[model samples]
Target: MTVTTQPDYRCTPSPLHAILLAGTVPLFLGALLSDIAYYNSFQIQWTNFAAWLIAGGLLFAGLALLFALANLIRADRKAGRPVMYLVLLLVTWVLGLVNAFEHAKDAWAVMPSGLVLSVIVSVLAVITAWLGLSNLRSGGAR
Candidate 1:
């Protein structure tokens, strides 16, 4: 008798994951643009809008990262440790939260560093999410 084993394929990502991955970059950019507008024009209202935009994007991106981490853990128990991704996401989330708070309070002095941090985090998140999504789609089977 002969036995054959087939490789297990990962499942496609959910709509929420897709949305989070798709929206994160644009949302981050929009927030950045709003910040620029506010800073250049000294418009308090624009800063408030930017703060909320960043907050909302951070929420969605954070959720997406959590979902990706869970899926990675389930798909490959031995080789699915995404520690860097997790750390970066966490840092991004924290920085974004602080930035949002500062923007809300019109603390322009400290907003630039937060904005830069947000951009860095957003880029890293996009890369990580793309890789995770690709792995899911490709079945990441050994």
Candidate 2:
């Protein structure tokens, strides 16, 4: 009997993965902003509409990430990592919206989920950009 391998899926960057590659940096910055927004002012400032806008943007970002993931996963052996990263980005994007709009009455009490998404987008920017570039390099994008 001949043995078959499951194909090499190690370290291949997915389009989504690359998108979130910049998230780590902004994550820290967002943390700082959240801290300031939460505890560093004499007056409280919050708005549901702003949060709603954030939710909408995050939703859009999630879609973009999903699109990138699909583009990177076209029967290629180097898309495993990128797929995982993209999924993570999707999850984070969804959670970002939830965190943004969970409480109708106490949105101010909640951290800016939009801030989280911004960070996500920022950090993932490089990764996603690279993944896209790599895909182009390989002519894997359809």
Best by lDDT: 1
Query: Which digits, one per residue and each the tens of the lDDT, describe model 1 over residues 6-124?
Result: 56555666788877866766776678878778667876777777777888878877887787677657654434324444555566667667666666554566367756755665676
RMSD to the hidden true structure, all candidates: 3.8, 7.5
Q: How accurate is candidate 2 locally (lDDT)?
A: 0.48
Give the candidate number with the greatest TM-score. Answer: 1
Score each candidate by Cα lDDT: 0.65, 0.48
Kindly give the stretch of ten consecutive residues in candidate 1 with the minimal lDDT sum: 133-142
What is candidate 2's lDDT per residue for 17-60, written digit by digit as tens? 44443343344344335434544452335334434444454654
